[model samples]
Target: MSNNHLTREELQDYVQHVFGASYLITQSARIHGGAQKVIYKIDCTNGFTCMLYVWDISSNYFQEEILNEPTFHSSYGSELFSLNTRFLAQHGIRTPILYDLNNDRDRHSYDFALVEYVDGQKAEAYFQHKNHKDRDELFQRIRDMLSNMHGIQRNVYGNANDNSKKAGPCYQVQRLDAETALSYASKHMKDIRKNDKRLLEKLCELEAAIQPRDLYNFIHGELGPDHIWIDHAMQPCLIDIEGAGFFDLEHEHSFLEFRFGDFYHYLKNNDLDPERMTFYRFCHHLSLISGGLKLLHRQFPDQQFARGLAEYHARCVVQMLS
Candidate 1:
């Protein structure tokens, strides 16, 4: 929206007047991604450049103007972002550092936080541009990063559940049963219907017969190339922890495998066998497709998102049934 508006002197003055005189915003750089929140690139604290994440007020948001929670989800997202930075930093993981956080309910009802800007391009783009010739290094780095992240996740505040001990052939089956894919795919052709029923029944049977193990940790639920950023040095740093949550350790590597293949270029470099990699990839796609279906199925949900999910489900069913 009016990219010029972000750099306007008057608006900058208002923000400065409100945030106090400790730091000067040299320039305001707006990030794309409408609604939900407004993000900006600002110079903040101790001569370092950082970003400001802020919430935007919508006419119908905040629970129909009556039942909004005490704190906005963006507020929740930013605060959690700060904690995420803390967790990663404590473990020597390379990430954009958090400088400060502010939650203000005044004037349009907004919340904001400041964080260091990790200079780089999205990992997906970066890898392709470099031709990903160093495939082995990239795979090792990814594996090590997720493993380190999970090792620390073992100590976070929200990782309370233990679904690992139940890990068996049936665990995947049980998860597939709880998925919304059944309804979406069932309305399709003979092959899809047959596959869906067989999959669900197998999952239920697996859950009962398989004795699972506890693979505990808070996983970066959205583990994909898009959420990763590779710095000028070509090192990987994870981002977009909005979907982060406690999950099966097996699920930690799901997103990556879903978008890429199970016998992925990265895993092959790391020597992860095709059979094991396929399982990881399956669980990853299943969980995500499940979540997407649930959100899309919400009563009177976002039509745009629903249509997107519909296309995605069509692809997923084809992939699964095949």
Candidate 2:
């Protein structure tokens, strides 16, 4: 397969293949700010709409070094999304239905999939415009959804695709064991070492203090309000679900706290291990530093936005150290 980006005609052909011979794309709009892949909103001749997900290196923001890192699986691929859709649905969680997936290397250099178009606004935007009472009701539903999702526990932690039978051996070990957590902390620290030695040192101190965990919860590894869609009927629909897995619940909460900011209290679990939260919070910022720097290094379209993200996290790291 040749390394070529999908043109409008190619995309039209793809939609026709999925929607049938007479199908035509009346209009298509590319979605912006997708760091790992290109997405398009396609409008077909008969008012049929769908989403196009194209996974190609050309649209990725991570540098080769970060992309090649075994521990960094930011771009897990279409298979995971398809698997997680069924998994999430089995738990009564909502997600857009996937229509088709294409991995034929001879036809294209990248993997792509067609998904049901969700006619809705992002949960973040939806939350912003809601009245106080409505907002409270929404949060109540969100809390329930998250509680149910995280309630699904496993003895061993890994990707959702991992076989349960094979997880028995690692049941005794925490996914975020001190050695593993500290090693990742140190690697991420390198990106910020020149900016703040004090924060770097504090990261080591924090990592050394992490408490061991025994149980793992199913989690959306990188959940943010933006990753949730509020359907026209006002139900929350999860997206960007390729990273769904079983891990320390604190890892998921840490990401929610940052992404949801002040709004996190409505969804926070009262029983979280405080020590795990603290360590995870620190690691979360470190990962942001690594991600932001990687975006900048790769010359992401919005250099200022990427730089600002890194700077904000750098400050958060300092505040945590203090």
TM-score of every model versus the real structure: 0.64, 0.86
Cα RMSD for predicted model 1: 6.8
* lDDT score of residue 268 within candidate 1: 29
lDDT of 1 by residue, 200-222 (tens): 65444434543444434656755
Query: What's model 2's TM-score?
Result: 0.86
- Lowest-lDDT window of 10 residues in candidate 2? 169-178
What TM-score, to 2 decimals, does candidate 1 have? 0.64
**Model 2 C-alpha lDDT per residue in residues 185-244, reported as the tens digit of each score:** 345555344445565566557655666555789999888998888887767888888879
Best by TM-score: 2
